[model samples]
Target: MSYKAIYTYAWDLQEAGVPAAVDEFRRLGLDTVTVAGSYHAGKFLRPRGTRGKVYFPEDGTVYFHADPARYGTIQPLANSLLAEGDVLGELTRSDMATNVWLVLLHNTRLGMAHPESVVRNAFGDPYFYNLCPSAPDARAYAVALASDVTERYPVSGISLEAPGWTPYAHGFHHEFALLKSNAWLENLLGLCFCEHCLASAERAGIDARRLKAQIASDIEAYLESGIDYPADMAEAFWRADLAGDFELQSFLDFRCGVVTSLVGEIRDAVRADATVSVIPSVARPTAGAWYEGSDLPALAQTAGIIEACFYEASAERVSADLFDLQRRLRGAGKLRGILRPSYPDLASKTEFLGAVQALRNGGVEEVAFYNWGFLPQDNLAWIGDAMRELG
Candidate 1:
């Protein structure tokens, strides 16, 4: 499986326009609702220069049907009409909201507490900063934290965004060292370098030395693709296409084993049957060979659905059908592709239609726009009718 050829399914959604949002979903004739992970208005409330208060409350608050303000409080599953498909706040049971997927921001309280639960390298230290799944403290924190979120919210799925497996994601090699083992401080300095990691790897017969070499190699791979390498690595991991080469299955096994352990624990603790999904950023080596080690086969092993992010305007740069072609390599029927509005301020109806037309023809079953917050209401009329007719 080289590139995951995606099937058109549905588009991303948000708690926009209240009841009108559902009407928009209907008008568009979309079948699925995709809520982004940690997309909230109350968050950071303001961007760099903005002064006015964020008009919409953070989606985390009521989107999950939970009172988002209180961290520990669990709201009653009060809304009888709330169904998973209601990406907007006011979903009714009668709306037939079905097959909705909510995106979750993944991280244990320990991730916040220890800050180092995520892997990082700062100064000259080679640290194990990633949340140590095998560690008792990490496990306890993960179980409690995930349980708290799901129990507090009314989500149908969890999207692991902040878990930071790739080592190239945001805050990669974050400067989060909590321990100061001289040997670890000198080397083996990442977050998971805690006592638990050493003991677990020893028990599992995982050669710590070998793991170190792999980390060095993988970090270099990330850097080769222009992704910043963690500070501690000796060399760069070569940048390759996220949609790998012929030996994809081997990498898939490793990815499945590695990522699955993290996600599986969350599902085991929170929603066991959570509809897990993956959406890799288009920022990395979309054009490179099998370097990023995406391993769609491996992703498929752990995920309920896999979505690849292709900016709506991508069609203009390449053939319109390229994204669909990418999806086709997966060979799995569960793969889906997502599209966002080309522009944040306003959408070009022509581009929307063209992209969708291309995606549909490319064998995709669904497409989604970013958020309702900025999408012009007038354009909503155009989208509703256009989307409904796609399938």
Candidate 2:
């Protein structure tokens, strides 16, 4: 049978009651419920929330109970609601298969607490939201979190999000930028030159100091020039620019090596029964993965599955993305596509069904929706309708 699932949050299930939510999921023709196990803070406007319309999650917390002994310099804080009762534990008890959605290496609370362990750009500006994967404590914390949840709960699998470097344009609280932002500028600013990163690159035979100095100099020159790079040509320009720079390309590859190794460690740590999957990049079109150090082919070997977030508007775009990703993966591992069936992606049931059809036609057997809390009642109906029609 084809696998179908819905991405959701534990808070949403708790609000609707676990049994009721399970029934609703089944009603929507979903076989799995992917709930947030560990996540960063977000101001979510819950359309289906009964208690309130807007909810702000506690920053950098886990929904499941985490064992303190399993952690290191960085530790996870349990969501206060976990004190009332374990939402994840309750979900695991249900007939529906449960998958833990873990946002690793992107914790603002932990990053701020351990500034030395976070990602620092070429100019030494620390991104408090992104914990450098090369840091020993960060790696340890990620592995422990993955293993701890799988060991305690009988989850079918774990979906790893933000397991690699995050880009510069992430939606931070009141993020303000007056200068015209382009891909080249963001990528340069997002490059991590932290102590751990530098040491890792050095060990891998890269001239870490010289590379950092060159990057800093180039960024300074770009800023001084005030070049208004066209948005259409930005990505192409960046790639061509990287092609000419061998040292920079090697550094990016080293970064991917860092992420791939960390994922392999997490895979080894988790229970043997649970499948490991990585959401390679949150970037659209999926090709922008390298900017965040997510190499699809490398991750395909390390991870059991690659959950590509195809957050596009039309079926044509979705098909094009699927084709490109499959070509890149070269059949190394299983590929799954995630689609948003709500506004800005799929406006009607026909569009949602078309996207599903596009994936199915592209040889993707598993399809997952974005979230249960964010979608409206009609969108849920559209999902059920799509599932039935496809089956």
Candidate 3:
């Protein structure tokens, strides 16, 4: 379909209220809105007097009863703006396809509260903000969240973000220093050895403890000597020597399997009415996509759409990124380009149009803006103008 959508948070609906916001979108000639169904903490809509971390507010989920029993407390935000019956239904009546955007794993509250469910590094230090995909409780939590959203809303699509395990240096405060101190070593350091993950490897007949110790020793040696570390982490993976390390290779495959299982579970849980999609995190030109455990071909079997992000400062670079994403997807699924409508690339009307054109040329069937609450009215209006130009 001719889908032109924008990404919005629940707070955006709260700020302008549903009626006014819907009118603004229609006035801008947009056909769909990918609203954040579940989210993490952010400063979105702060200018409109909205504040603090919010969870499960707009989502009408009672949550799995086992959630609170298994983990001390399960609390989601209440008094949500979309709690009203008419808000989302109104979008549907207005012929606006509502796409529910769920942030799957990067939840600060869940990650901080349940350390056992989060990622553990080679040193066994838990990264409290990124969930481990191998954790049954964590995967169940995600599936429950997805099922709740799909069951509650008459959504046209469901977009899953951060569904895989996060990489090292994600929540760590020493990212810059770590980058300077053998960044490739940081890749080796980030491998998870959590109990759940270890058990998974052991089930596959791989010696988990021995592999972890070897990885730790290698990382430490690289950090101390700054020698023998591959200049690029991506190259290290493809090198024949790493392939010889069966345990290391198995661990990599295991990570991908965990992510695939979770994504597949969510896809199966959600009703067939809503299209399921995933946004895999990849820092361009890097094999970080695979490192993030998103096997595109595998995920495509369940996820019908792949929402590729095109957040570059230059329109030309935006085109390049979209092209790169298209190549990676390899017809695995439909592509939807997500753009940032702010300075540099979208500073002028021509630039904004150029970005849209680039996405279109890259074979993106649809396009969506990054956020409604984060930018100014001028930027929002730019989207309207750009749509008119495309027409």
Per-residue alpha-carbon lDDT of candidate 1 for residues 296-378, written as tens digits (9 for 90 to 100): 54454555555655553545632433553365446652555555553632257776666666666766664555444434455
Could you tell me the TM-score of candidate 1?
A: 0.57
Candidate 3 Cα misplacement greater than 4 A, ranges: 44-94, 172-182, 223-246, 285-287, 344-348
TM-score of 2: 0.97
- Candidate 3 global Cα RMSD: 4.5
- Candidate 3 clashing pairs, residues 3+ apart or interchain: none
**What is the full ranking by lDDT, best candidate first?**
2, 3, 1
Clashing residue pairs, backbone N/CA/C < 3 A, model 2: none
Winner of 1 and 2 under lDDT: 2
Candidate 2 weakest lDDT stretch, 10 residues? 170-179
Which candidate number maximizes lDDT? 2
Off by over 4 Å in 1: 1-17, 36-110, 122-169, 172-256, 264-275, 280-294, 316-329, 344-347, 378-382, 388-391
What are the clash counts of all predictions, listed in order? 52, 0, 0
User: Model-by-model lDDT, in order?
Assistant: 0.41, 0.89, 0.71
The C-alpha local distance difference test score for the whole of candidate 1 amounts to 0.41
TM-scores of the candidates in the order shown: 0.57, 0.97, 0.83
